[model samples]
Target: MSFTLAIVGRPNVGKSTLFNRLVGKRLALVDDQPGVTRDLREGEARLGDLRFTVIDTAGLEEATDESLQGRMRRLTERAVDMADVCLFLIDARAGVTPSDEVFADILRRRADHVILACNKAEGSAADAGVYESYGLGLGEPVRLSAEHGEGLNELYTLLAPVAETFEARAAADAPEVEVDVNEDGEVDADAPRKPTVDKPLQVAVVGRPNAGKSTLINKILGEDRLLTGPEAGITRDSISLTLDWDGMPTRIFDTAGMRKRAKVQDKVEKLSVADGLRAVKFAEVVVVLLDAAIPFEQQDLRIADLAEREGRAVVLAVNKWDVETEKQQKLRDLREAFERLLPQLRGAPLVTVSAKTGRGLDRLRAAVEKAHDVWNTRISTAQLNRWLTGMVEAHPPPAPGGRRIKLRYMTQAKTRPPGFVVMCSHPDKLPESYSRYLVNGLREDFDMPGTPIRLHMRSQSSKNPYKNKKKSTPSRLRKHIHGRGGAQG
Candidate 1:
């Protein structure tokens, strides 16, 4: 029930800039260059205590022909439809243009709520441009500089009521759900009900150049804080930004584009890739962004495999969907290919989006939240043991030293990919194949088909501490044997 706010504007109008301002991070790529952003990115945005989901949309353009621009426009239209409130932004320095008018008309017709923003209104020179924005006829324009971060208070005031109303409605519709873990790390089914809001959702955004990774984040944040360019490899660090997504607190990590190791020659690129790896390691859910035209490369597969190995939930995002043709067939083919090539992550959610246009961003967020939910799931020890009994009965363990090792007890040690520990007679003697079998069984039996399962075996040893300390020899026995033999003779 998170409220959603979308920032929509034509290219280079500071939509990403506004997004970054709201999210309080330089997560989106910011450049003076036009058409730098290409995707709709969503983030958890907070203004004072008013928290909600925010989307940074790609700059819109008029495209009636079956071209990339057309796709971008379609994507923008979708974002406007889905948003609870739409912030239509314009550059106060450059004055109003036809693109702005077209998009404004679209927003007026489609969006239920609209907030007109005159961005880059830092000086008196921008007053003319700001005044011209009144022609769009949305409302009194909130003149603010996304670059200088001026006039944010007015923006906050505008959004607070909308957010509060949304929260009230959500609370009324859904009963509170509480999750509790006992001393032994098992969830109590009958725990007292409370609202869910403790751990922050961990999300990692990763992709190749110009795939709109930074743009998407900026759009969600409502600011242009990150440096963006048309050139490849602009981001060299995995930057983390914490915010509220539809009232859900989340930490989103923006990572560098992963390339084939063989093709990586520069030291900077290597460092960037390494940093991205670290992000993947720490993230609970990884969103793999792909250019729709070149979706699912070998390197992409490698990255996805690495995430699986690290026990992270993965969400696949096909970026630049606005530019692609044959969308349905491509999505189907990519899914099939993923299943064939990376079956370990079967049923991993795939989302098609325009990081530039903000299309399918809400769905992307939903998919990520779902993946995270599955990732954090833990099974009860009793249930696990029961499942293990069935599995061991079906396929017995291999004998070691002419004796079959007995598995005495089992319990889930940790979650976030679900690790378990098993007590056995000989832990070291357990075969690799048997371990794989148990992992597979747990995955299949527990409805955790795609998630990685870790199984560890520990042996029990019993020994006395104070048994053998000192020994005394019977020395007189040898002398007595010799004397007795002589006397007898």
Candidate 2:
């Protein structure tokens, strides 16, 4: 029994700030710059026992052409249409402008329910603007200061009735069913309750700007859910969507393209890059999209390395493959560059796809599934000990200063990137090369290619029972000593 509420208004009116407050996280990038938010981001919102979905949309503008602002405005309008109620906000200190009036008219016509709110009304500076909002002909405006957390109680009061109505409707619409019980007052064993299933896998799609990330996602969804164009840096927010792929539930995040730190001079772009990094951290598998014609650029390598460092299952997707004329040579070049430039992600699935034409999507999905499986792989203690024995025999650990480092036992400490702990003597003396050797063996022998493996060496000193006890002289020695003393006397 949940409904969606879209926070819509002109730019710099604190829509994102309010969104962050409602969702209890900084999911939306917030800055003083207008038009910073270019996509619709949704989150679960709760306030005073009320639960619903909240959407943060781009600022409403008066553009109507093919400009970026115009596209952003259209996207915001789509969010308004999907939302159950639209919270149209205006800067209380600045008062309502012509753009606000125009957008208010649009929301009045589009949204079935609308809640007018005047934000930034923390002090008397906004009093005049709050009083002037009555001229809009909508209802009373809720006084709010999103940054300072003011006037939220009034908002909850206003929304309680709407939430009640929704709950009642949902309860009435729910289907009714009957269950049978035996005379012993127990339910029939044949009618077992269904087991709960796990949530969908979280996969994030990320790369440099204009790498066809949005286009690839659109191809998968078979619709234009994400806005796409030839413009670079079109996507500014990391948008997540859920879908069913071949009977498997999967949630995918489309993140903003990452650029070199030196090249990113704008504040909004910095926030965008930070948002993309957050998405990678939140995701279980990360798809590093690359332009097929120019694969493995410095920025591309950085993105892949970042993913690997985050311990996410990595999959390389070379987009726009349909335009490549020399397929075999290009693929060979890609593989060579991948191996040479980024050995950290060696043997990771490098999938080539044409996002526009929807080519090789199946292979990409399969590779993602495989990478996730490998990332979550676990090995039994027996198997790990056996593997450790063979590895040590093949390449015994180095002994510095003639003191041999004893390798005792090995076991997997955890999964989800497969961490292992090896008990040995003189763990501090273990070299990095030996650790790499064991990790590579685990990857190759365990069929865990491209998955990050953690091997920890622990020092286990052998205990000596007699070392802590006081030593006593032997009886024979003591008797001999006494006899020697008497003979000397």
Candidate 3:
């Protein structure tokens, strides 16, 4: 079950800081800038023994009735409605302001459970503000320095009860249901999980600065809609452009160039890089544009690795391909370099195209679609089992401490990178080498090379199908009638 908790607060109140803290990574872009987080970003979070999803929302601000801020506020309110709880953060140093009071009123009127937190409360100076937050009527404020990782334990304790109650309510309200996945790969009324509306397929164009991200988008758009320049880091925020590719809705994002981590200095640049990463996370397909002059840099490999780890479909587009004289050699070298550098994304579709010259654009689109198709590929349980049997027979699971590992049933639990769950005797006892072998074998057998494959092993106890049935007894009346039968109730 997935329960969401949304973090809401004014701008620069360390909401993104706390968001990153809870999600256990830099999933949200954090900056001193007020509105760095314009979109509601959701991530899976773990607090103590509780696991739920958390959403980092845009800052609340006053806006004209028909302004962008109004729309953003509407979106934020919608996120709050979607969540099971709301964490309203206030700047401890600045104390509660008029805007905070307004937000408090809104939360109090709507939200049943609101956890107020005094952010940036590191020293005695914040004590007064923390006390003032009690006026909001949202119970005792959980003092926290989101940047310094303070007051999380108290926050967890407060959340545990709420989490438990939410879980209980969910279980009680949930319908008694069984799912039957049909052969057509579509879910019927009995399906386990039903997805929401399938929106446009997201494609992110990412590479070094001046790799023609905006130019690529402009070319595809056939207009100079996005700002293009020879300057680096020209585009800070990721801009999403929607279009139709063969009648299928597709959204392409033009992101800022991601430089090597060692060189990242300015606060805005850092935020921009983080935004690019978030775009990658949300994308289904990533077209890594490469400069013809300086292709296959270390940073490019790192970015590709990030995409693979995120289970995104990857397409390597060699931008400025028209300018290169040694086309065949460059292509070969690029392929060879990618194979060596990013083996996880090996065999990923590579196309040579000039975003400036509009050359090979069709091929780039075709490669992207192909990669997307591969990413969504799924295999049957019976087929997977057959392949598994063959693999174990050919090179069986290795044994450590003289105990042979017993791998039982295998099934593809989910698609979108083709995740499989294998039932084994001891999952933790399985060596990494053996796991890699099975994953590689699946990739090879299914002809899904370069597509990220996740194989998770679990230790499950087998159960008899008739374990729950009660034994029937013969009746005494029937025995009397039949003379030689046993007694029954």
Candidate 1 vs candidate 3: the TM-score winner is 3
Best-performing candidate as measured by lDDT: 2
**Residue-level lDDT tens digits of model 1 in 1-489:** 778998989899888777888899755666666765555667789788888888887678888665656655676677788889999889899999987898888888999999999998998999999989999999899988888889889998998888779888988899777977678986665332222445577789887656778878876676654545566776666767777777668878888888777889976567667877888888888988888887778887887888889899889888888877888889889888888988778778888888677889899888887777667677888988888788778888988779998887799888777789998888898988899888777766776656667789999764566569565546798688888999999
Give candidate 3's whole-model lDDT.
0.83
Clashes of each: 27, 0, 4
Candidate 3: where is the Cα deviation over 4 Å? Answer: 1-198, 462-489
Candidate ordering by lDDT (highest first): 2, 3, 1
Better of 2 and 3 by TM-score: 2
Evaluate model 2: give its TM-score.
0.89
Off by over 4 Å in 2: 175-198, 470-489
RMSD of 2: 6.6
- Candidate 2 lDDT, 1-489, residue by residue in tens: 788999999999999999999988888888887888887888889888999999999899899888888888888999998999999999999998999889989988898999999999998999999998888877999999999889999999989989999999999999987978778996544231221225788889999999999999989998777878889999999998888876658888999999999999998898889989999999988999999877888999999999998889899999999999999989988889888998877789999999999999999999998898888786788888888889889889998999989899998877667789999998998999889888888888999999878889998878886787988999999999999999999
* lDDT of every predicted structure (CA atoms): 0.80, 0.89, 0.83
